[model samples]
Target: MKRREAREKAVQTLFQLDRTEMSIDEAITYIIESPIDPFYERLVKGTVNHKEEIDKTLEDKLEHWSLERLPKIERTVLRLAVYELLFEDEIPHSVVLNEAVELCKRFGDEKSGRFVNGVLSKFEQK
Candidate 1:
């Protein structure tokens, strides 16, 4: 799968992990195909591995909203995007930001895209 599909898969996988009791492997397997894209694997696993740091960073960026107060899918998207911004140096920051907004749009409420965009823009400015 391409990066876009991989990103979508990563978002769903991460969301499943956050909202359910599924293990990382189970979450990935449930969300992705047998030959999982390498990028997708890295996104899910890396995000999980670095979740504490990611959440902390997001907490600092959030204006009025606490990380846990965010909707599940939006919180998942933010975590995944923060992973890319902090770890996946190979991917452009703009791509990470854009893909995150897209994910929120696809899986979250109408305001999700704007919320994600606003949070991600803080990373870009720094």
Candidate 2:
């Protein structure tokens, strides 16, 4: 699968982790056992490892928006994108933002795609 698709899978799994309250080990094991690409597994693990920092960066960029107040899907998408933007130099910022917008359209609330785009755009400008 493509890296973008892999990222989407990671976002979905992270969102699942929030709902299921699965320990990192459990979530990692479940993802490993699934049909996900190995690249995706790596991305998911990296994001989870750096989630605290990523979320904090996200919170700072979002001004009044608390990470907790975001819908789970939107939160996960932002986490995944920010992780990529901050850590994965192989991927361009534009790619991360585009993939996040697509994932929001697919998995988030109706207004969420645009909301995500707006937030991510601000991050890109910095």
Candidate 3:
């Protein structure tokens, strides 16, 4: 799968895991139709594995908004982007940030892209 496709799937799977309390294995299977792609597996597992740290980082960076107070789509997109930013060293920071903004634009509300870009820029600066 293309990385963009993997990212979208990752966000969907993560959203499922968050909202339904589904197991990682179940979430992956539910979202991905083909045999498991390695990139997809890594994103979903990595995000799940590091969610606490990611959430803490996001909590600290968000202006006045708590992570929990964000909409579910925005929260899930941020979690996936943050996972890529912190864990996926093979991908450039700029690429990750750009992809995240694209994903937000596609999956979230009109302001999501800007909101995602602003939050991720803080990570890029760090």
Give candidate 3's error at residue 104 in angstroms: 1.0
Q: lDDT tens digits, residues 59-90, model 1?
A: 99999999889989889999999999999888
Pairs of colliding residues, candidate 1? none
The Cα local distance difference test for each model comes to: 0.89, 0.80, 0.89
Scanning candidate 2 in windows of ten residues, the lowest lDDT window is: 27-36
Kindly report which residue stretches of model 1 are placed more than 4 angstroms away from their true locations once superposed.
none
Backbone clashes, candidate 3: 0
Q: Please report how far candidate 3 places residue 64 from its true position, in Å.
A: 0.4
Using lDDT as the yardstick, the better of models 1 and 2 is 1
Residue pairs clashing in model 3 are none
Worst 10 residues of 1 by lDDT: 117-126
Tell me each candidate's RMSD, in Å, in order.
Answer: 1.4, 2.3, 1.3
The Cα error of candidate 3 at residue 88, in Å, is 0.8
- Per-residue lDDT, model 3, residue 51, is 93
lDDT of 3 at 13: 92
